[model samples]
Target: MAQQVRGVVARRKGEPVSIETVVVPDPGPGEAVVRVQACGVCHTDLHYREGGINDDFPFLLGHEAAGIVEEVGEGVEDVAPGDFVILNWRAVCGRCRACLRGRPWYCFDTHNARQKMTLTDGTELTPALGIGAFAEKTLVAAGQCTKVNPAVAPQVAGLLGCGVMAGLGAALNTADVRRGDSVAVIGVGGVGGAAVMGARLAAAATVVAVDVDDRKLAQAEKLGATHTVNSRTTDAVRAIRDLTGGFGADVVIEAVGRPETYEQAFYARDLAGTVVLVGVPTPEMELKLPLLDVFGRGGALKSSWYGDCLPSRDFPVLIDLHLQGRLDLGAFVSETIGLGDVEEAFATMRRGDVLRSVVLF
Candidate 1:
């Protein structure tokens, strides 16, 4: 028999989400049903509600989540019932070319559950990022549930599934920030702050944080930034160059996915230095940089997709680091709300009043 659970649903674009009774079917082949313990209020979830991602009406919102597996479908050996896990969107297909090549992080054909969760009227609900977890329970492919140290709290552990992981992976994996390298992160949101911490974790010679807001800059400093720059009232490129001994940062991370910030990231790095764009940009946005600059600066300009992370490998290690008192995963949780508080959480997130307003079950 199917289960009925309360969920936050976006019935239409730009309208408030509502708590509705969602019908969750029992797991089918390659699927698992999760009893969500905590889910973060990510900007992406807001994007989905605003019709920024797609026109998938009546979408099931929420992706950054952690929970206990209640049931597993046939052939699901990786995770079993009672296991605590963090949900991820990218469930790699083992036979994909990227996986066969040993770079499973770049798995070209990731997947989600085949069955759809629906409303009482039988209208299909599109799960946000293929892992709609804002509800009491969610369905996901088995591979999407990465088992981690269960001792960690659900709210903090869940964050590793999205934004924070993106930042850490951008600095530690994509840019490959090394000891003695100078790193500067632009935009001190949850992602940028994590990038700063990643640089510090890598023992970078200098970790500079650039943001338009002073409050965020202060938060970055607390998160291991060696220096801070208020880009709104200063020349970011010049300040970054000055901080880096008249050159620039060896790696510059653009966590604000806007054209102006991207341009700043381009010029704020040393010649031949890497620029990692971890920010999610809107489709209408475009960059118009001079061609010569791209040619003259001979390093890589890359975009990090989900922090170029492999959940099975990265999530456990990161959770361990948190458990060991290394990564301050708790700082990101500014407040905790209920499933009914999602609308207000969205408002708080829009005002930049909170780093992450988590929904606790």
Candidate 2:
């Protein structure tokens, strides 16, 4: 039987999202239905509402989510009904070139539910990140569900589904930050803040956070940033170098995704140091840099996609760490809000007042 649930939906571009009746069908082959417990309000969700992601009108927003599996399709063995799980956007297909090469994190073909959820009028709704989860229940590929320890709160565990995972993966996996290394993260928002925590988890000796807002910088400090630089008042590149004993940081993570910030990250690293670009840039944005500098910079320049994470592998470990008090996932949850408060949450996110405003179901 199909179920009718209230979900946050963006019916048109540059318009406010509303709680609409979403009709979700039962799990089909290779799919599962999850009862969403909580979903985090990410900048990406707002981007979709503004038509920044695509022209897929009537988008079912919200992706950073944790839930309980209520139903599973035939042949689904990984997760069963009643299992607590974190929903991941990337569901790697083993035959993809990236996956075949044993790099499933870079899998070119990820999976989603074959069937579409719809509005009451039968209009097909595109799920944000292919996993529209702001609803009370969402259907996804069985592979999209990653089982984690159920003891952790849904609000905290759900974050591993997106931004937090991206930031942590940027530093720990993409940059391979090491003990005693000097690391600098630009932006200091949810993603950047998570990078700061990732650097701490990696045992980096010095972690520098660069941002325009003092409040975010203060939050970064709470997340384990050894130094903070307000780029609006100080030259970020020079300040990072000064903090790293004049050689520059060993790794610079660009979380702002702007050309100017990219350039700062390019020059703010030590010789042979890595620069990780985890920030999402707009389609119209172009990056122009000196050819000589590109050639002269001896280290790897990389972009982190979803922090290059394998959800099945990373999610449980992160959740366990969070439960054990090793990782402060709770700090990321600035507030818990009801589904109707999504529009207001977007405003709070834009104001940079909170790391995350989660929609608690």
Candidate 3:
């Protein structure tokens, strides 16, 4: 039977989200219903609420989530009931060309549940990032459920689903940060802080954090940044170069999507070093760079999508690292709130008051 659950909903652009009754269908073929235990409040959710993503109104908010698989439909063999899982937006279709070439992480065709979750009035809701997880229970494609160790708390586990993963993967996966590499992360927010942590985990010799906010720079230091730069007061590129013995970082990860920060990242890396962009930018934003500089700097400029992560391959290993005390996933959860506090959480996020305000079911 279909179930009715309370979920966070953005009814219109620039309006605060409201709690509404969402009709969650039972799992259908290739789908699964997960009972969400915790969901993180992300900036992207705010974007959806503000209609920054599209004209899709009445979006079901919240995507970074962890849960238990309560039921799995026929033909869904990847996950079963009672499994602890992290819900992900990318459920790779095995037949896609990316998958055929064995790089499923770049799978061009990712999917969600075939059925639409709707309002009690039967209006369909566009889920945030194809996974509407603010509700108590949500439906997703079976591949979206990545089972991990049940020992980790849902609040910490859910983070691996989105921002945290994006940051970590930006360094570890996309940048391929290696031991002895010098990494500088710009915009030390949740994602930037995670990149700092990733660089440390990879045993980077120096991790310099650059941010306009002093509090975030402090937080980044706690996440293993060897040095912090208040980019607002200092020339970020010059400061980073000075810190790296006047050579610049071996890798620079830009977690702020603004063009200025991106330009700073371009100049803050050593020759032939990589610059990874993990930040979310506005659609109308444009970046102009010198063509000569692009040619002069013989390095890779890459955009990291979801940290280039493969949910099935990345989630469990990351969870295990956290369980072993090698990774500090819990440091990212600044506060926990109930479902009703999502609107307030959005305000908190905007003010940079917290790294993450999670909604616990």
Candidate 4:
């Protein structure tokens, strides 16, 4: 039977989200229903609410989530009820060209449940990133649930579902930071700080964090940044270059996504170094760089989408690492609140007041 559950919904752009009774269809073919325990309030959720993502109105918000699988639809053999899992947006389609070419991480046709959850009035709700999770129970494709170690706290484990994974993946997977390499991360927010942690885990020798907020820089230091630059007053490119032996960092991760910050990252790297862009920019934003600089740089410039993550492979390993105390996933959870406080959490996030104000169902 289809289940009705309490969920956070944004009925229009730039308006506050509200808790509403949403109708979630029972598991269809290849679908699963997860009883959400914890879901992080990510910037993407705010973007959707603000109409930055698109005109997808009445969005069911929240994506970075972890919970228990309560039921699975027919042909769902990989996971079963009672399994603790992290919900992921990317359920790779094996038939996609990227997957067919053995690069499933780049699979273009990642999917979610074919069925849609709706409001009581029959208005369809577009699940945020295909995994709307700010609810007691949510419906998703079976492939969206990545089983992980059950011992990890749901509050911490859910982070691996999105931003944290994206940051770590940007450094280790996309940027390929080498042991003893110098890395500079621009924008020390949730994603940037995670990039710092990833660089530290990857054995980067000098990790310089750049941000406008001192508090965020302090947080980044705890995450493993060896140096910090408050870009608001200082010239960021010069400061990063100065901190990195006057050449520039071997790799620069641009987590801010703005045109100016992108330029700062472009010039803040050593010759032939890498620049990984994980921050999202709006459609009106355009990046213009010196054509000669691109040719002269002589290295890869890449954008990391969800950190190029294959949830199945990455989630379990990350959860185990968190369990073993190697990664401090717990620190990312600045506070946990009920679903009702999502709008306020968005404000806190915008003011740079918290690392993550997770919504606990």
lDDT of 3 at 119: 98
Ranking by lDDT: 2, 3, 1, 4
Per-residue alpha-carbon lDDT of candidate 1 for residues 186-265, written as tens digits (9 for 90 to 100): 99999999899999998899999999889899999899999999988999999999999999999999999999999999
Residues 1-361, candidate 2: write the lDDT tens digits. Answer: 9999999999999999999999999999999999999999999999999989999899999999999999999889999999999999999998989899998999999989999999999999999999999999999999999999999999999999999999999999999999999999999999999999999999999999999999999999999999999999999999999999999999999999999999999999999999999999998889999898888878989999899999999999999998889999999999999999999999999998899999999
Candidate 2: where are CA atoms >4 Å away?
Answer: none
Where is the poorest 10-residue window by lDDT in model 4?
Answer: 48-57
lDDT on C-alpha atoms for all candidate structures: 0.94, 0.96, 0.95, 0.94
In Å, residue 8's CA in model 4 sits off its true spot by 0.7
Residue-wise lDDT of candidate 3 within 190-299, one digit each (tens)? 99999999999999999999999999999998999999999889999999999999999999999999999999999999999899999988888899999999999889
TM-score of 3: 0.99
Model 1 regions lying over 4 Å from their true place: none
Better by lDDT, candidate 4 or 2: 2
lDDT of 1 at 226: 93
For each candidate in turn, give its C-alpha RMSD to the true structure in angstroms: 0.8, 0.6, 0.7, 0.8
**Considering summed lDDT, which 10 consecutive residues are worst modelled in model 3?**
47-56
